[model samples]
Every structure is written in C-alpha cells, then in structure tokens.
Target: MNTSLPPVEAAPTGPDAPPPGAAPTAPAKVPMAELFITFLIIGATSFGGGVVAYLRNALVLQKGWLDEERFLSALEISQALPGLNATNMAIIVGDRLRGVVGSVVAFLGITLPGATLVMVLGVLYASNAKNPYVNAALIGVGAAAVGMLTAVTFQIGRKQFGKWIDVAIILVTVTLINYLHVSLIWVLLTVGPVAVFIYRPSQLEPPSVPPKQETVP
Candidate 1:
C-alpha cells in the first residue's frame, strides 16, 4: 500500500511581507485642499434630502477620505449633534482629518457656497413664485437627488455585507427602521446584546501549569 504525504500548513505572513516583489502599499494621508473642495462641491449639489447620501459618496466612495467604519461612526456622531446632519458631519470629518483648522475649513467649504446659493434661490422664488423654469429645474434636481441617495444606500449595503453577521444585522435593522419606524436606540437595545452574545470572540486561556515536581525529586 502507498502512503500519501500529509498536507502542508501555510506559513504566517508579516505586514511587510509581499509576494514576489509586489508593489508596496502606501499609508493614507489627508489632503486638505481636496477635502475642502469635495465638501464644497457636495454642498452646492446636494439639495433637499440628498445631503447624507451625497456626503457618503463624496467622502467615502469617490474621494476615499474615510473608510466604511469611520464613515459610519461619523454619521452616527453627526446625527447625535445639534444642527443639520450634513454640516455637523462636515465638522466631525474635517476635525478628524486636520484638527480644528480642518473643521473650520470644512465648515466654510460647505456653508458659504450653500448659503449663497440658497439665498439666491430664495430671492428668485420670492420674486417669481410661479416660474415654470424654476419648477422644472427643482423637479429634475430632486429626481437626481433620489438617484444619489439610492447609490449611497447600495454602497453602504455592500460594505456591511463584507461580514456575514453584518449582513444579518443590516437586514434586520432595515426591516425594523423601515417597517416599524423604530428609533435606532431601540434597535441597538434589541440587537446589540444579542450580537455580543453570538459573535463574541473567545478569550485565549493562559498556558496550563504542569503539576509541581514530586517531593521524591
């Protein structure tokens, strides 16, 4: 009878290790000018309910300024803050990247352009209450905003599904939030403990001590 060789175990890899001279990965650094420009553009384009969705796209998907987890955390924090969600998010994200100066720059980037645009629109609406062009433009922009929001949703869903448990949580949270209109606190209260119970990683035990040498030794 012939004996087959046992399967070999793979070697552990170090962070600096790469396969066959592959290109090295670079560390991420914040680009302040780009950050300001991005938020400014998002502010100008984001109308009505499009702020959150556009911010997600501009910051995470398009610019890669923040990863998914960081983006989600910023969103949560912004929501808890007083003021508009987009503006609050700008401050948080800016501060995260460039400290206080970054926060101020980000705020001005989002607010100044938006303020000017809104004021102009307000004047126009007041002067020309029944203008067809205004109505048409608003309707078209609103539809585009919906498309952007949908894109943001899809992006977030993709990130969440990177983990199987995340997918389950997402599905459940979406169901509760959409159908039941429950607050996030309630959702967290229901799912947080259960998730902890189910997915908690096992703590490693200390190596066992051998029995004390016998007195006969």
Candidate 2:
C-alpha cells in the first residue's frame, strides 16, 4: 500500500465544465500563511530563470488555485510589465487570490529568499571567484536554466506552432533579437501591435454579409 498521492493534472474538469481556457469565475482563497509559504518555497527552490516553471507547477498543478489558462494569462501580464517575471507574477496572482494583503505577503515571500541568497553568494563568489568547483557549478546551473526555459517555451507555444502566422511571428521575433540585433524596445513597439492586429476579432471573423433573402414557402 503506497502512502503517496498521485500527481495532479494541470486542469481538472468534467464535460459540463467551462472550456479549457476560460478563467474561473471565483478563485478559491488560501490562508495567508499558506500562500506565503508556497511562494517562498518556489523562490528558494527554483534555480536560474525557471521560476515560471515552478510557479506553474505549484499554482496550477499542485495548488489548483489557478487553471492552466488563467496561469498563462497571468504569465503574459507579468511579461508585459517592467519587473522580474517571477515577482510580477507573484503580485498578479496574489492580488487575484488574496487582494492587497495577499499581494504584499506574496511579494515579500518570493523576494526575501532570493535577496538573502544573492547577498551570500555574492560574498562567496568575491572570495572564490576562480574556484574550479564554483565555476563548474555555475556552468551546470546555466545549462539547467537553458533546458528549463526551452521546455517551458515549447509547452506554452505548442498550440501556436501549428499556425503559420504565429510561427512567422516567433521566427521574426527571434531573428530581430538574435541576428538583426534590434533593441528589445523596438521589437516590442513594432511587433506587438502587428501581432495584435493580425489576431484581432475582425480579422478572425468572416465578414457579416446580410443573410440571403429567403423565398417564402
């Protein structure tokens, strides 16, 4: 008899449930202490740039506080903002779940651990800048970060890959950043609006021609 529970799925819904991407009408709130502990754990354990991966696992897969669609929505909002993605996500999801107080609690929880670790690591690196073991560890961490980011990118964009327009957008964005060396500001200012227009409602919907006149029976 195994004592462990099964892993939770990303979205748990039955036939009658709302469509997959719909945001839940009301999010179930957790205790403030619990919320803080959750983000704190994520902040401490998530290495490199993979905080978003940890966030998705904790918030959607484990906590069930947010559905997969809602998690993605929050992630997009965080990316558009001016701060670190992990902190921005903390604020957005915290507000949704626990209001102003929750946001404060979450922000502190997520930042405090990283802040402390950075200070300590900075001191250690200053003293042992050329230590082979330390250098090797950093390189390993970088590799893991790249792998995490790649997996998450593919998971998030799997649907878009099939759409030529979306694929074009991805390619263009990468080309601009990698080959053309376009400033990120310019890329966002130009590509963002074009992408929006391409997917706008009017472009997606067929023109509303008047219904063909029906012959009276």
Candidate 3:
C-alpha cells in the first residue's frame, strides 16, 4: 500500500538563485543614438558655461543614466585630464554607456552644434568688426560671460570655500597670478606641488604619542 506523497522540490539555490534582499542592478547597455541625442541637446541648449550643472541635471536627475556618485567620479577624471570638460565628459560617459562608437557619437554631438555656431559667429564678426551695434552687442556678451563665469566658479567651489586650506590655496594662487605677475608654468610647478603636499594622505594621519609611564611607589 503506497500512501506516501511525492516529495516537493526545494527552490534552486547557488548561481540560479537571486540573493535575498539584493536590489537588481540597472541595465548597462544604453543605445548609441540615445547617447548622441542627449549630448546634442546639451550642446545646443547649455549656455553661460554652466554645462556641468546642466550635465548633472540631465544625466543624473532627469535621465537616471548615472547616479550622483558615479557622475562626480567621472567629472573628477575629466577635470584631471587635459581637455574641455564638456567633451571630456562626453567621451567618458559615452564610452561607459556604449564603448568606442558611443565615444565617437558623443564627441560629435557635443562639438558639432557649438562648432557650427562658432563658425557662423566668426563670419559675422569679421564682416561687422567696425559696426557700432555689433561692437555694443559683443561688449554686452562679454559682460554676461564674466558674470556667468563668476557664478559657475562659486557654485563649483562652494564646498571647498568652507575649508580653510582650500581658501588659502585659492588666495595664494590668485595673488601669484594677478599681483606678482608670476608665469603660469612656474605657478603650476610650485603651487601644484605645495597644494598636493598639503592634502596628502600622510598629512592626514594623527601624530602618535608614547603611552604615559606608571608612577613608582
């Protein structure tokens, strides 16, 4: 008399099982065309040199393409290297999303609009160099550019402004460049090393003191 029920199978474990309480990661593959279009929009619309802010807003906040930490990490790499921040960011983010094709498309998208606009402006400027109206417009544009630059500088440096060391470095650098008329090369060679040393890991360590000796009876 076989009365025993069939044994129930346990759920599969190991590689087949998703880890308990772990979140699913976002997809890695973004479309190349999407990358190009995103940068194209940024290039055409971003003005006043606030492209970094625009980038953060679009990629991190609007699109969810990158988290804040990841965006900042990429920005740091871009800033450390020699190139326009916008293009550098385009290449890094594009490569991260889709590889070589992504990089090429992003670079073209970010640059093409600006390049075309610049060429048109150059032609117009050359033709109307002595026109009073054009001269007035250029002056107005320059003033606006200065204001934008100052605003962007302070916005980017807000965190650093709270720190004394950063403020000191900034002041010294400004004095050297503006007041002393130091050559850019010499300033970089000297101030760069000093600033690096000031913030080095070794300088962050707390000094070790010998333990107090026991008193004799």
Candidate 4:
C-alpha cells in the first residue's frame, strides 16, 4: 500500500472541516476541472489491489472529505453495483461531492489517464509478450495487483465486521458464495437486507434511561 498520507489526526479547518451535522455535509463545490484533476491523480498513481483502500484513506481519512458513516454507505452501494469497483467508487465519491456533475468529473478523472497508460502498455505487451523479460515484468505487476487487492479486503473487512452479527453474515455469505457457488444476485438479495436489519448500528444502541430521583427519608 502507498505510504504517503497526510496526518489524519491534525486539527480540522477550512471548507473541508465543517462541524458535524445530523446529515453529513456535502463537500465544498469544487470546479469540475479540479475534481477531474484530483481523480486523475488518484487513477494514475493508485497501483495494484488496494486502490479502494488507498481512496478511502486519501479522501475520507487524510483529507477529511467524508465522515466514516457516509463513507461506509457509499462503499456498500459501490460494492453492490455490478461494475469495476474503482469506477463504481469514482461515481459514488463524485456524486457525493457534486451530484451528477461531480460524478461525471470523477468518472472521467479515473478513466482517462489510466486508460491511456494501459493502452500504451497493452500495445507494447502485444509486441513483446513472448519476451522472457517482458513476461516476467507482467507477472510481477500481476502479483502486485493481487497484493493490493488483499490489502483492500483486509481494510474493508475491518470496517464491515463491526459486530458479531456482521461476522456471522460475512461467514454465511462467503460460505454460500464459495462453497455453494450460488449466484451473487441471489446472495445479495437474501443477505443485503438481512445484514442491514441485523447489524444496523442504529438498532444496536441501548435505549436512554431516565435519571434516578433522590429517595425521601
């Protein structure tokens, strides 16, 4: 994983550091130009498997652009969608930042630079894939991608498995998917709402108790 992160614990300030509210505040409206540039940077540099983890750390933790609850909501929706995780993430994050415009900016930002780079690499590989050195390099890159993905799994798992019920749901879901080889749509349709009902942080809280009165002699 990339080690470059700004200090998360630093005192908050600026437009990005608004006070907490019942609903999380939207990010300051940045120009489409700026949004595109920021995501372009993320797309260009975020290598291997941990891209989503890197994105969460970068946007939510280090940048303080999103609170934890909101971030998790977006992540859940993104994972449920049938598409490339990173691309889905871009849409979610962008939509949060600036609604439809932000989503378009983020999508373009994530796709353009990386697509160009990959295209170039693909052309080169098409010519040189048979070469020992090129093949070895591709294999190394593939391994790095897997390593990054594993890191993302660990990070997301930590966030998702907040309660014992969450663990149970995860175990059950994994078993159904891996052992039974059940279709994902069915697994999600079954588990998604159940997990939402069972592990909802709101439902798990203790009810407020009234203060006790003093006893008369």
What TM-score, to 2 decimals, does candidate 2 have? Answer: 0.64
Stretches of candidate 3 exceeding 4 Å from the true structure: 1-28, 205-217
Q: Is candidate 2 or candidate 3 better by lDDT?
A: 2
CA lDDT, candidate 2, residue 187:
98
In terms of TM-score, the best-performing candidate is: 3
What does candidate 4's lDDT look like per residue over 1-217, in tens digits? Answer: 6654334323254445555332345554444666677788888888655577777877777656678887788888877778877888889888878789789889999888889988999999899989999989889989988887778777768866786876888899989999999999999899988977875778766657786687897
Per residue, candidate 2 scores C-alpha lDDT tens digits across 1-217 of 6644332221254344554335556543466887889999998898757789899999998888898898999999998778989999999999988899889989998999989989999999999999999999999989988888899788879999989999999999999999999999999999999999998997787778998888997
Clashing pairs in 4: 49-148, 49-149, 50-148
TM-score of each: 0.47, 0.64, 0.75, 0.58
RMSD vs true structure, all candidates: 17.7, 9.8, 12.4, 9.5
- Sorting all predicted structures by TM-score, with the top scorer first, yields 3, 2, 4, 1
**What C-alpha lDDT does candidate 1 achieve relative to the native structure?**
0.77
The local distance difference test score of model 4 is 0.77
TM-score of structure candidate 4: 0.58
Arrange candidates by lDDT, descending. Answer: 2, 3, 4, 1
What is the alpha-carbon RMSD of candidate 1 to the true structure?
A: 17.7
The Cα local distance difference test for each model comes to 0.77, 0.85, 0.83, 0.77
Per-candidate clashes, comma-separated: 0, 0, 0, 3
lDDT, candidate 1, 135-169, per-residue tens: 89888989998888888777756876687877888
Give the lowest summed-lDDT range of ten residues in model 4: 4-13
TM-score, prediction 1? 0.47
